[model samples]
Target: MNREAFYKLTYGLYLVSSLRGEKKNGFVSNAVFQVTSNPPQIAVVCNKDNFTSQLIKDSKLFSISVLKKDANPKLFGLFGFKTGATVDKFESVKHITAKTGAPIVVEESLAWFDCELINTFDVGTHNIFVGQIIDSDLLDSESEPFLYSYYRDVKKGKAPKNAPTFIANK
Candidate 1:
């Protein structure tokens, strides 16, 4: 069977942020999705070893910033492509502290969601964190969401090994 077909599936790029005390980190992910309406729930898939995962475990809080199409690629390089253990991910970016105390990027984002972890499911290499939406807001009226297809087909972006969408080409 051909695995290349998996690349055609559509998704959206997002930055998932988490914080615990002074520890804070974020990374680009396409696995974020809305799971419910009433009470409003959302899920985020995080690599087991990601620093943000540790933060989420300790704080039980997170925020998602829907990136606009025009967001700088450098932002992804800092927040997505690199590990937050060595460097400060928020130093190079502009953000605000949510009521949940999670750092959220408000710059060039179409929208944002503040979430409280309700439950979690361990899925081998990743843990799926389902959270109850505590708050949400539209940051910009005319901003266009950055599509995963645009990252691959248009901008030629590749999924990181930890990304849920990363399937080995065997």
Candidate 2:
């Protein structure tokens, strides 16, 4: 069986942000999805070791920022390639604090969601945080959402090792 077949799965690029006390961090992820509509819930998967994960676990809150199709590549590098533990992820990025206290990047986001973590499932190397949407709104209806396939096929972006869909470098 070819592992490349897994690439057929559909995904969308997102920015998952959280706050722990006064500290804030966020990271790029492709494993965000809506799980239910009745209760308005969403799920986001993140590597256990990611700084953003720790913040989510501690704060029990998070915000999802849907990256726009024409988003700056530097924004990806800043959030994905760099470690928030060593640097301030929000230093240069323009964002607003949600009612949940989680920051939402308004710069490249087409929409944003503020959530309250309702449940957590431990998956190997990562945890799936199920959040009940507390608030959400469209930032820019004109801007198209950035899809994972677009990031790979058009932007030529590769997933980092910590990503759920990361294809190991051979």
Candidate 3:
């Protein structure tokens, strides 16, 4: 099977964040999708080793910042490349705590969602966290959402090893 076929699937770039007590963390992710509309449910796939994943599991809540097309690459570098285990990602970033106590990244975000985790599924190396939308807001109606394709083609971004889209060296 050709793994390249998966590239055809569209995805949006986002910052998925959660708080473990007073400690907050976030990471860049692309494997997020709306699973239901009636009850307003969304699912985000996170690697088991990710610090943000543990925070979500502990807090049972998360926030999603829909990144804008023009978002700064440095923000992605900070969250995607650096480990939150050592770096204080939120120290310099401008964000606010959502109603669910999840950190919501404000800069260069077109929209945001605060979610209450409803269910979780272990999928090998990743966990799928399904959440009910508790709160949502549009930050920039005019800006277009950042797409995974754009990240790769325009920004020359590559998915981290833990990312669902990551293709290992063969």
Per-candidate TM vs. native?
0.95, 0.97, 0.97
* Per-model RMSD to reference: 1.4, 0.9, 1.1
lDDT per model vs. reference: 0.89, 0.93, 0.92
> Per-residue lDDT of 1-170 in model 2, one digit per residue for the tens?
89889889999899999999888889999999999999999999999989899999999999999999969998899999887899999999999999998999888889999999999999989999999999999989887899999999887898888998887882
- How do all the candidates rank in terms of lDDT, highest first? 2, 3, 1
lDDT of 2 at 86: 95
Summing lDDT over every window of 10 consecutive residues in candidate 2, give the lowest-scoring window. Answer: 161-170
Model 1, 96-153: lDDT tens digits are: 8888989999876889999999999999999999999998889888878999889878
In candidate 2, position 142 carries an lDDT of 89
TM-score of model 1 (CA atoms): 0.95
Quote the lDDT for 49 in model 3: 96
Q: Candidate 2 — which residues are off by over 4 angstroms?
A: none
Which pairs of residues have clashing backbones in candidate 1?
A: none
Worst 10 residues of 3 by lDDT: 161-170
**Models ranked on TM-score:** 2, 3, 1
Model 2 scores a TM of 0.97
